[model samples]
Target: MSYPICHEEIIEDRDVTAQLDPRGDVAVLVPAAGAGVRLGPGRPKALRLLGGEPLLVHAVRRLAAAASVHTVVVAAPAADLVAVRELLAPVAPVTVVAGGVQRQASVAAALAAVPAGPEIVLVHDAARALTPPGLVESVAAAVRSGHDAVIPVLPVVDTIKEIGVGERVLGTVDRSALRAVQTPQGFRRGVLTTAHAAATDPLTDDAGLVEKLGVPVVCVPGSEHALKITRPFDLALAEHLLAMGR
Candidate 1:
C-alpha cells in the first residue's frame, strides 16, 4: 500500500534543512517551464501559487524528503532562471537551468544537467505539485530493482468509450486493463539518455520514447495526491485537498 504525505507534513518538511546524500542513487528532473495555457493567464504553471507558494516549491520539498534522491535539476522558463534558483534555494539544493519551448525539450535540458552519480533518473512534472515523498522513493526503488523503466499508475475508475469522427461513440471500452499514468517516471540513466537522443517525434511522456525502443516499462501503484494541476478547477481542488489536511 502507498502512503501519501499530508499538506501539514509538506510544510514541516520544507522548514528542515534537507540532508540528502550526495552519493545517493537517484536524480530527479523536473520539467517546469510550461506555459500552462490550459490553466489560463498567469505565471508559468510551475510558478503558479499553491497554498501561497509556487507549485515548484511544494514539489521540490516533497522530492527533497525522499531519501533515495540525491540530485534535483529543474528546467525553468528561460527568463526566470535566476528567480527560480533564488526561490528554490531556501527550500532545497537544486540546479536550475533555462527550459526550452516544449516539455520534451525541458526534460532533455534538465536531464543534461544531471551529474555523474545517480544511476537512476526520474522525470517528474512540476504540475503534479502535491506528489508525496513516498511515491518518489517508490519509483526510484522500482528502477533500482532492475527495471529498465518504471511509471506509477492508478487503476482507471471512469468508464471509457471509442468515439468516431462526428463525436459518435463506437463502443464502450474495457476499463479493467487500463490505468491512469502518473509522473515521477523512473528510468535507468543510460536508458533515458539514449531514448532522448534517439527521440524523433514528441511524445507525451518519456516512457513512450523507451517503448519505441521495445523496452518494457514497469508500473507501480500511484497516489491520488499526485494529481496534475492543469485547469482552474484542478488548482481549486488541490487547495481544497490541502485545506482538508489529507
Candidate 2:
C-alpha cells in the first residue's frame, strides 16, 4: 500500500551506536561420564556428594534455575548412566546419554545430542558442584551476545613455578599473565561443533579446542566458590567453604 508522506522532513542523523545484543536458545552440557577414579569407586564424579546433595544434582539444579539457560544434558558413563538418570530426574528436565572415553569426547557427544539450528551451549564440569550461578549466567550472556566462546578464569594467585619430575623446580614461572581457567564455559553451537569436529587430540578443556579454531575466547572473572572437586583435600576444603558460607 503506497502512503503519502508530505510533511516537514527534518533529518537529524547522529551516530546512534547500537550495542551488539544477541539472544538465542541455550543448552548446558554436563560431562558426567568420568569413573571418579580420584574419588574412588562410585556412580560417577557428578554423583559424589559435595555438601548435602550429589555434585551433579547441584550443577543441574543451578543450571535449571539460571535465567539464561534453557536445557540441561548429561554425558554420563554407561556404568553410571542409570544412577545419574534416577538421581537427577526430579530436579530438572535432563537428558542423560552415554558419554565417550575422554572429556572432549563426552562434550562432543553431548553437543551431538543437542537439537540442530543455532544455539548457545555451555560445557560445565559436573564435579564443580558449587559453581556459582552468576558464573554460568555471565558466560551464557557473553555467548548470547555473539561471542564465539566465553570462559571463566581466575588469576593465578599462588607463586608460579616450572617444576620438573620428582618435584624439582626447573625455574620460577611468571604468574602475571597466568590464569587458572574454570568451567560453565559457554560457546556458540556452531563454533563448538566446528571446534570439536576439527579436534585431533584430547583437550584438557573445551576452550582448547576453540583455541585451535583461532577464535578469541572472552574471559570473565571466576569465583573461589566454583572450585572443582578433584582430591580428598579439595573435598574437605569445599566442605569448609560451604560451612563458612564463602
Candidate 3:
C-alpha cells in the first residue's frame, strides 16, 4: 500500500534543509539598455523607479540572491555603465557591459563578456523588477533537469480575442492553447549561442529565436509577482507590492 508523505517527511527524504537543486552555477544576463521611449521621454528603462530604487537594481538583486546563479552580466549603454556599476558593484561576481540597440544585440554583448560559460544561462529583462525568488529558483531547477530552454509562462485567465489595427475584432483566439510568456527564460549556453547567431534581426523575445532552432522551450508556472514594470501605473503597483512584501 502507498503511504502519504508529509512536507517535512519529503524534505527529510531529500536529505536537505530545503528541496532546492544542487546545481545553481547558472549565469544570468539582465538586459537594461532600452531607452525609455515607450515608457515616455527621458531616462533609460532600467533607471525607471520601482519600489524606491531603480528597476535594474531590483532585477540584479534578485538574480544575485539566487544560489544557483554564479554570475550576473548587465548589458546597458556605455553612458550608463559607470552609474550602474556604482549601484551594483557590491553585488559580487557582477559585471556591466555596453549594450546594443536591439535586445538580441544586448544579449550577444553580455554573452561575449562571460569568460566561462555556465551550464544554464538565464536571460531576464531588467524591466521585470519584481520577479519572485521562488520563481527564479524554479526556472533554474528546470534547466538543470536537462531541458534546453525553460520559460516561465502564465495561462491567460481572461478570454482573448485577436484585434485588427483599427481596433476591430478580427476573430476569437484559442485561449486554451495560449499562454502569456514571462521572462527568466533559462537556456543551455550552447543552445542559446547557436539560436542567437541564427537570428539575424530583432525579435520579440529570446524564445522566438530559440524556437527557430527547432528546440522546444519548456514552460513552468509563473506568478503575478513577476510582472514587468512597463508603465507609470506599473511602477505604482510595484511600489505597493514591495511595501506589502508580496
Candidate 4:
C-alpha cells in the first residue's frame, strides 16, 4: 500500500518535503539558460513568471524542501546571474553560476559548482517548476540504492506515430514501451561526471548522455504536478494549478 504525497509531507521549508535515503547527500543542478523560443520570447525560460514569481523561485523552494538535498546550483543566464541570485535568495540558499549558450554547457557549469561531499547529483529542469519534492527524493533514493542513473517518468498516453518526411506518418509506433521522461534525473556523481566528460553531441536531456556511456538508467513514477511549463498555455495552466494549491 502507498500513501499520496500531501502537505503534511512538507518539511521546514515553505510548501514541500520528501523521504530521503540516509546515505544520499544530494546536490541539485538546474540548467536555466535556455531562451525558450517556443514560449514566445521576452524573458529567459527559467526566469519567466509563473504564479507571479519567477520559475526559478518556485523550483528552488521546492527543491530545498527535500531533507537530503544539501545544495542547489543553478546555471542562470550569464548576463543575469546577479538578478537571478537576488530573485531566488528569499526562496532558498542557492549558488548561482554563469550559464552557457547550450543546455549541456550550462549543466557542466553547474556541475562544477556542486560541492565535494554529496554522493548523488540530480540534474533538474527549471521549466518543470512544479515538480513534487517526493519525486526529487525518489530519484535520490534510487541512486543511493545502487542505481547509477535514475529518471522519473510517466507512461505515454497518446497514440504514437513514426513520421518520415513532409508530415507523413510512415507507421504506427508503440506506446506501451514509451515513456514521457521528466527531470531531476538522478545520477551517481562519478557516473554523471564521466558521462559529461565523454559527451560529444548535444542532446536536450541529461539521461541520453548517460545512456551513451552504457550506464543503465532506472525509472520511477513521476507526479502529475511536475508538468514542464513551456508555452503560453502551459504558464496559464500552471498559474491555475498553483492558485488552487494543487
lDDT of each: 0.86, 0.77, 0.79, 0.84
What is the alpha-carbon RMSD of candidate 3 to the true structure? 6.8
Which order, best to worst by lDDT?
1, 4, 3, 2
Q: Single out the weakest 10-residue window by summed lDDT for candidate 2.
A: 2-11
Which digits, one per residue and each the tens of the lDDT, describe model 3 over residues 137-187?
Answer: 777887888988888877777988889999999999887677777789988
> Which candidate leads in lDDT?
1
61: Cα error in model 1, Å = 0.5
- Residue 88 shift from truth in candidate 3, angstroms: 0.4
**Tens digit of per-residue lDDT, candidate 4, span 99-207:** 9999999999999999889979999999999887877887788788898888887778899999988999999988777777888899999999999999999998888
Two-way lDDT contest, 1 vs 4, winner:
1
RMSD from true fold, candidate 4: 5.7
Task: Residues 18-103, candidate 1: write the lDDT tens digits.
Answer: 34233378899999999999999999999999899999999999888788889999999999999999999999999999999999
Q: How accurate is candidate 2 locally (lDDT)?
A: 0.77
Segments in model 4 whose C-alpha atoms lie over 4 Å from true places: 1-24
Model 3 residue 149 CA deviation in Å:
0.7
Q: What is the C-alpha RMSD of each candidate to the true structure, in Å?
A: 5.9, 11.9, 6.8, 5.7
| Consecutive 10-residue window with the lowest summed lDDT within model 4 | 2-11
Q: lDDT of model 3 at residue 147?
A: 84
TM-score of 1: 0.90
TM-score of each: 0.90, 0.85, 0.89, 0.91
Give the clash total for candidate 1: 0
